[model samples]
Target: MPSSKDAVIASLIKSFEAAPRREQPYPHWYLEHCLPTADVAELTALPFPAPALGGISGKREIHNATRQYFDAANMEKYPACKTLNEALQD
Candidate 1:
């Protein structure tokens, strides 16, 4: 049997290849199982607090300081982030 990481990558590759390319109402594919259940849970469990937007709606870049992006530092710190990043790159 493949390892968990291998399995997730394989699943993502298969799902992405199978996803249809639609052009009608905006082109997009309905992908499923992009991430494992455990990985999803881990991501949702991250302790990053919500930004105090002060009732103002704007681009996500507005809270750049508060929001944690999946950069090299974050991937090194979060296993799920690393896994998801690798899977996408595959």
Candidate 2:
């Protein structure tokens, strides 16, 4: 059986691979732009906590942190994100 950490990493990879590629009507533009430039290899190289078997907090933290990084990097482009952010901010 794979160790817990291995299983977690595998699951994360699977989830990313399985995520649908459909575009959102008003997509998160920062994410859309950043993904092509984002270094998945570098990200996977970072040390992260082993995934929790039952709790979502671990995954949530990873997701939120990545979002924050993308948001900060793309803040200047927020004007372009008008439609999506407006709906989200309300």
RMSD for each model, in Å, please? 3.2, 15.6
Q: What is the alpha-carbon lDDT for the whole of candidate 2?
A: 0.38
How much is the lDDT of residue 22 in candidate 2?
A: 53
Among these predictions, the greatest TM-score belongs to 1
lDDT of each: 0.75, 0.38
Q: List the candidate 2 regions with Cα displacement exceeding 4 Å.
A: 1-3, 26-90
Q: Candidate 1: where are CA atoms >4 Å away?
A: 1-4, 17-21
The residue-by-residue lDDT of candidate 2 on 10-82, one tens digit each, is 4445555666555687533222222211234333333445544454454555555334332443434432233
Model 1 Cα shift for residue 15 (angstroms): 2.9
The alpha-carbon deviation from the true structure for residue 5 of candidate 2, after best TM-score superposition, in angstroms, is 1.0
